[model samples]
Target: MAATGTYTETFVELIRRASAELPAEVAEALRTGREAEQRGGLASIALNTILENVDLAREASAPICQDTGTPVVWVHHPTGVSTRAVKADFEAAVREATARTYLRPNAVNTLTGANTGDGSGRGIPFMHFEEWDEPRIEVRMILKGGGSENVGAQYKLPDGKLGAGRDLDGVRRAVLDAVVQAQGKGCAPGVLGVCIGGDRVSAFEASKRQLLRPLADTNPMPELAALEERILREGNELGIGPMGFGGSTTLLGVKIGVLDRLPACYFVTISYMCWAARKAGVSIGEGGELTWLS
Candidate 1:
């Protein structure tokens, strides 16, 4: 089946919006963090600079961060639509976005260490597609920066070093340790997306995908929800503050996902995102109307 120009245009618009604008929820979290800091302090100053940068980027339609990071797309579509066609449309959009500077040339060759000037290289703009019963198509994109990406961590259950066993308490230990280890390197105050159980690769993928969730939304699982809250509170208590300058606020939010794993393996994965937190989604109807979601 042939993809329409409108579809391609919609993809381009999604890229532009996701690249250029910080999502509303993330922006609100930043504002709240700024207000929570002590007046005229280093943390407060850092937050002010961050908020200013956010406003300028949005107003000018420029990338919110120097490192545009990686484009990870999740597409949920009706069964009849072609996944291949959807991918092709998105790849074309990425090329156009790069030419237009919505994205920098971020695709790097793993072995040769060469940059893919067009932002389309082997495995770049990584995509995940799912078939759904819903008639409309929903596309969600997260631009995860390299700085925060560097701080992502994974832990095995029953870790002797931390005295963490294969349980909820253990999971909490691992998550908090990750935050302490990251310090200001990942660009605090940051948001964390975590997965409780899964194999190595799937665990990391689920952790990153959890970042798509809104900062204000609580997890349906009461246990997980409470853990998220506790993590956020304790992370801030670390005094890593904004950009690690030291202050009251260190974390903006925490989101967790759980997946069942094998009997012998228990894994916890942490995905860190800087305050920029560039994420946005759109729903495209069959008639070509677009609805924005965050």
Candidate 2:
């Protein structure tokens, strides 16, 4: 089996689908969040509005959120396909997606403060490519919005301020602090993607990558899975509510990933995703059979 298709078009379709549709897992999470809220409460109303917007966006083929977000793409390719080619096509597709209004012109010149208008700047539309032994190409994408990005947090262990030590309990303390600080500012009833180890930069990267996982998927590691569940429970207890309106549905889910770190540094990085957790993936098999992933 060999690959056959217009790579550029397939890439553009991927972006369009990710931008316009809310994955079903995320939708289900929101449904659960809504049910958790008190009847006729602010959180309930907010969740209802969000659910309605999701439906409207899908039907109209419009972006689920006005921000459209920064495109974080990860490509896992088989032996023969060139990563350079995949990146080139991906960038072109991003530009096309922007021009066609599937994505907003989100990229800008940071120092000069100039908008690129085509969704491509020096480091905008970040991409990572990995070689795999499989016979298919898997492209995972996450459209992370600025508001949620603003709420992302990193913590160093042995911090006396919160009485957090260099352990999982410390990680939990830091994570809860982040949620409290966000206070519905990053769009309440959100999902949290956490990295429990790694250095500053790598921890943040790993945390963002955790957002690629579906909301309903469970972590393979039993300890991490338990921690995720506990965090979800405790964070919601803070009562940040939907949009910070103060309700029972503060967080929809928590996803955690861990990486080994240097002995001296203990870092916990959290990447927050708003209610509109825009993520989608696609796989092109050796026979060029395309599959959409949530």
lDDT of each: 0.89, 0.89
TM-score of each: 0.97, 0.96
- 179: Cα error in model 2, Å: 0.3
Residue-level lDDT of model 1, residues 5-88, one tens digit each, is 556878888888988889877778888888888999999998889888888988988888878888899999997988888888
lDDT of 2 by residue, 1-294 (tens): 222335878888898899999998888888888888888988888999999999999998899998999899999998888777787788888889998899999988889898988988887779888899999999999999999999999998988999999888888999999999999889988889999889988888899898887777889999889899999999989988999999888888899999998999899899999988988899999988999987
Name the runs in model 2 displaced over 4 angstroms: 1-5
* Pairs that clash in candidate 1: none
lDDT (Cα) of model 1: 0.89
Please identify model 1 stretches exceeding 4 Å from their true place.
1-6
